[model samples]
Target: MSKKLAVVTGATGGIGAEIAKQLAQNGWRCLLVGRNETALETLRKSLGEGHEIIVEDLQDERAMAAIAVRADALGGTALLVNNAGLNQMLPFENTPSSMILNQLCVNLVAPMRLTQALLAQLKRTHGTVVNIGSAFGAIGYPYQSIYCASKFGLRGFTEALSRELDGEVQVKYLAPRATDTKINDMKVRAMNEALGNKMDSPELVANEFMTLLNSSARRRAIGFPEKFFARLNGVFPELVDSAIIKQLKTIKSFLGTKESSL
Candidate 1:
């Protein structure tokens, strides 16, 4: 019998790479998908064996198609982690048209396309789909309109798909708040620091995320106030709105001169 396979997008760094290592340790064949070939090779070499590297941009129209063909050749994928996403720190008004489009394409569209391609294989194996979302997806934050939109869309996709596939396949949404990764830019980091927002390490996030994937939970948000805030905001929008309004000044202090979209 062939080993079960797990596909992790953005596998060259941070939580994506950490998740790949964890899955490999769990006796699963890993497909390291990323845009950087050199970084992908470096990570692949560090991992033991039964791992394959797929260097491709998640934004590419053909990437998911190529992945589908590759997964079939590798004896089918038992797990799919849509971890490839980009973050920007500009205010809405300052956000460029191109950046907004790119963020939408990478963070939201790519995951949908990739999952669509793997649905057949996932159904055959009772496989799991994990969408890496964000705390912003739950609570909209300043200077992250585009990022928040993408994550929110991802969360919705994961929830709808989970019900749509119910007994056929397992779908999970794992949201992490303010992860300490390269995904955070200098200004973004400064804002988090100033605001006293919590940041989780990539490894820590990956471990917790993996645990949820292995369980029966459908969706989980990481971090303290973040998780609490997400729920509170849902039931009491005015409460969250007032709290966020108070932090607007502090959050905006870290923004670059050009960013003023809020």
Candidate 2:
């Protein structure tokens, strides 16, 4: 039989690359999907042989269909990590319509569509679908309006699909606190530092992801205060709103600048 395969989108990013490496080390062949062909080739080489690369932008519908076709042909697809995502840090009022649409498409729609396309293969192998969400998914932040909405949608989709496919496939959501990746720019980093927010490393997130794969838990949010606040916000959102209101000034100070996407 062919080896079990793991298709990981955004495989060129910090967290995504680490996830691919960890999966490869654990004996699961990886199909690294991202828009960067050069970086994908470099990552593929680092992971040794038996792995593959899918160089396509998640914003393209054809990319998702092509990925589904490739995964089906490869067979034994045991895992799909919907890790590709986009974020813009500007204030909602300052955010452009195009950026908002892009974020929603990449962070939410693409994952939903890709998972739907791969459902049959996943069911065949009783595979798992892990959506990489963010702390903002549960606790909305000041400058991340669109990003929060996208991630929140992803979390809801994962919950609904988990129940819908319960016995046939495993659906999980993993929320990581702000990680020290290129995704966060200098202004974003400064804001986090001013707010005393903890920024976890990509390695830490990858390790937590491995733990999630091994556990029976349906959802796991990483970090100390982040995990606490995600649950707290779920139960009492008003309280979270109050807390965020206090940090609004600091968050806005970084806003007026141009947004960056990774």
Candidate 3:
């Protein structure tokens, strides 16, 4: 019996990298996938022998197919972490079509496609699929419209699939709130600070992800007020809308958009 394999996307840096390292530490052989070969290789070496690197962009269908092929060859892939994501904080009016498409592709489409590709193997191994989501997935923020849509779609996909494949395979959604990662630009960081939103380190997210794997829970949303707000928004969105409305001016200031135009 060999070690169970875990295919982790976005293993190059930040939360993804931390998750990969933590998985390796927990005795799982990881298939580190990312566009940066150098970073992936460095991470793979640090993780030691059995782990491998797949240098491919998730946005490219050919690259994704290649990843499925490699995973098939590797055999026992008991876990798939769709952790790769793209985020940008901008007013919807200022957002270009390309940015919207790119965010959707990386955040939602790639995860769906990659998961579909590996469904057969996962079923054979009775594996788990963990989709990394965000607090905004549940409570839509003003400037993060497209990001919220992508994560919301992911949460729905995970929920439906958890029921869809209950006995055969496990499906889980892990939502982390305002994680401190390079994914958040300086402006976004400043906005978070101004809003007094607490940011969790990448290691904290990795640990929470590990806990999710060991537990039987189907979904776990990190943070205190964020998790509370996520549930609140689901039951009473109007209340959340009113609260966000109060902070709308502060949020808008971070958008870097002109006041007159908005």
Candidate 4:
């Protein structure tokens, strides 16, 4: 049998790197995609022979073509993990238009384009598309409107695309809540302290994702209270809204002083 090929974006980051490592260890020939050449090379070496690396900015128009060329060279791609994302916590009014555009390009548009480019190979293998989303995608949060919007769009796109595929391909949305990644150290630490809990490790989330990949599960919401909150928000919007408003006050207090304008 031919070896399964899996492509993972943001493979230099904590979660993405773990996912790539797990996939490679689990008998799949992994393709690591990220902008960090040094990190990508390091990961590739760690993953051993047969693993490949492609360094390209996901926001670049040529990124899809680069991915396609790599896929062709790999013989075919069986799984595509769209895990690259960007987030910033700031008042909406203060957020620059350029930042918003960058967020959209990285978080939403890149995945869409990459998926479209790899559809044929995936269809041939009856492969899967794993979209790494967030809890904020399911519910809105203060100071993260643009980030939430991007995730929500990704979630919606995954749901609709899955239905459209009708089993020709598998689609899964993995939502991990407030992970202890280096991306937002201070903020995450503050939130954890305030909530009296620790942030989930990227490795733990990666393990859950690997399990889901081997199962028939179409969607997974990771984390304890966050998952519960997401479901609650879905069932009772008003209650969820009230709770978030109260939580926002606490978060604001933690942040110290609220800005009148963006």
Best-fitting candidate, measured by TM-score? 3
Q: Rate the local accuracy (lDDT) of all candidates.
A: 0.89, 0.90, 0.92, 0.88
Residue-wise C-alpha lDDT for candidate 4, range 72-175, written one tens digit per residue:
78888899999999987877877999999999999999999999999999999899999999988998988788999999999999999988997799988999
Stretch of 10 with least lDDT, candidate 3: 253-262
RMSD of each: 1.8, 3.5, 1.4, 1.9
Write the residue-wise lDDT of candidate 3 on 1-262 in tens digits: 3489999999999999999989988899999999999999999999988999999998898877798899989985789999999998988888999999999999999999999989999999999999999998899888899999999999999999999999999999999999998889998888889989999999999999999999999999999999999999999999998888887778778876666533
The 10-residue segment with the lowest total lDDT in model 2: 253-262
lDDT of 1 at 85: 91
Model 3 TM-score, 2 decimals: 0.97
lDDT of 1 at 260: 40
In candidate 3, stretches whose alpha carbon ends up further than 4 angstroms from where it belongs are 260-262
Model 3: residue 145 alpha-carbon error in angstroms: 0.6
- Model 4 residue 240 CA deviation (Å) reads 1.0
TM-score of each: 0.96, 0.95, 0.97, 0.95
Pairing residues by index, what is the TM-score of model 2?
A: 0.95
Which residues of candidate 1, in runs, are more than 4 Å off? 257-262
Q: Rank the candidates by lDDT, best first.
A: 3, 2, 1, 4
Q: Is candidate 1 or candidate 3 better by lDDT?
A: 3
The parts of candidate 2 lying over 4 Å away from their true place are: 256-262
Clashes of each: 1, 0, 0, 2
Q: Which pairs clash (backbone N, Cα, C closer than 3 Å) in model 2? A: none
